[model samples]
Target: MIATDTLDTPAAVGSSAPAATPALPRGLAGTPDDKEMLRSAVELTRDIATARPEVYWPDMLLSAGLGYAALAGAILIGNPVLAALSGVVSALALYRALLFIHELTHIHKNALPGFRFGWNLLVGIPMLTPSLMYEGVHTLHHARTRYGTAEDPEYLPLALMKPWSLPLFALVALLLPIGLLIRSAVLVPLGAVIPPLRRLVWERASALSINPEFRRRPPEGEFARMVFWQELGASAWALFVMWWSATHSWRPLLIGIAVISLTALLNQIRTLVAHLWENEGEAMTVTGQYLDSVNVPPPALLAPLWAPVGLRYHALHHLLPSMPYHSLAEAHRRIVRHLGVDSTYQKGNYSGLLPLVGRLARSTMLPR
Candidate 1:
């Protein structure tokens, strides 16, 4: 223990791994009490699934209720702005639900075809906005949260970018749009040109159970392919919706496109903000759980909305995806106590965002 403490001291930074963290850190969110929280969360999830798994019936009903109220506001008072705003919020909700699907994607829950259909039909449509190709890359991010030379699809290597280079930062912001467009428009369709992607997904899904290779040692050239497939799926979905509203004219269609685009921008900005403190080549830690994800503190009503996609209680999400979001806070509490470390939560310290920005500006000069 004394040796571990000495090595963990700052003087040993460049020499070797901290003695306290022999093989990276363990029990990040799965702290001493994690087993208890997991047990409780699992019991609840099982009940929910047994009674109503498919369609997330309870949640769908709630969304529908919200939608109905929004619809009433739209048609009764002819308040397009209010209606549009509600649609925007609902759209985000739907997107989060799709993210929930991602939580289940690797779990091998194929036994519940009904739940699959529900999530796909409800959440799938909105998720169409983000290319699945991009999403498939997420598997890589989860597989290998640490920095490596191989570019993980979810690799947003901004942590090490020059802190003073606003121009470079701006370039990244600019590419967000281009990347979205190309992924939606070009890459997706081109994927069909090659028949190997399905095999890749199958490979990834299988590997999720054991190898953890998808994220750690990313597959060659698959990231590009993932973006391509997403483009194809999103374009087709977008066209379908536009056609449905065709008689409503291209104006609303254009407006919808604009709205989704703006939302994407917001999403991108949020993602960048999360990893502000991440140093390239640093091992993934509990802090990265929320630092690499969106944070939401308690007392926020919208926390529930964020939780479905695994962004809510980020600490637990990192440690155990199977632990439903509802139990994340308690799990995090226990883990922090056991590990004697602090990780980012949904809401962060006031200064967290600012230092990140300043550091980001000067990051490129940093030693990797």
Candidate 2:
């Protein structure tokens, strides 16, 4: 979750704020205000493509359906070989849908009341996670995550290694992907059993920053409810798949379950790549939001598959959570216009890596 201090700063269109300095792979800098970003995206969208309302709606639906069908068919056939194939197709589609989920959250709705709810229900159930919570938490992360000591939970967890420990550190970082699977499949679920453990879960669910510097006075009951809603939603989807697998055949059901879990796991890794190592000990002020956000365009092959849903122009989304996801790339383009290329990552190349390689390199986050 993005803590209050993590998100309290701001970056404006022309303001010379000292944004988060780039230390990672992407060309991340500056935490500009949402309006400035929105304006930029609007201008850029005019040049790239029409930024129409629901522009990517059809594409999202078609891909999701295709992915869903592929997964289901593969499972129904009861061939392990087919299941693997379907998993790939489904994983790709699900990934793209995730970006849209981000985009959809940024959408402003007035006329499409049922459409909004239905959309959430459909996507939420299948994905086994609530998009709304991620939207909120992600906004905070983008706003204030870059400026912290080991104190920030989003950054380092404190306790740096001595020179002797470098080998161990490197070893663990190399297993990032494997560690991620372990964390998700085992750690997260196991941790929930204890009180302190549960509170952390609650904090994450509510998007509360655990770091005292970034802590906000949130509504007490809200986070627990979010925890219930989000987890139950995902678990319920799993149960539904279990039942479906039992009836029509276990193959598709098991495959769906695996694909869904793996996809979410992969998404978590993507989130990690955006900002796993950047922070400052500086005292945070309202203007501090500028130093936390970063931007990168994934490889072209990955973008069409993932950007429409919201992963492509992510830095802008962090700076301006209110801007819809579909418009992020454009919004980023706009910010780049005034801020120069340094404001964004121009590369359209996917960073090819497995989860294991990522963990070994940066355990703070899962692999992208």
RMSD to truth, every model: 8.7, 10.2
Where model 1 places Cα greater than 4 Å from the true spot, the runs are 1-57, 60-84, 110-113, 126-136, 144-149, 163-236, 242-248, 282-296, 299-310, 336-368
| CA lDDT, every model vs. true structure | 0.44, 0.48
Write model 1 residue lDDT over 220-275, tens digit each, in one string.
48545644443445668655654677656555444444444544444444444444
- Over the stretch 125-225, how does candidate 2's per-residue lDDT look in tens digits? 45544554444444444344343443443443222223333244333333333333333344446666766655564455333233434442233475456
| Candidate 1 lDDT (Cα, 0 to 1) | 0.44
Q: Candidate 2, which segments miss by more than 4 Å at Cα?
A: 1-52, 78-82, 109-112, 142-250, 280-294, 298-301, 306-308, 334-368
TM-score of every model? 0.56, 0.57
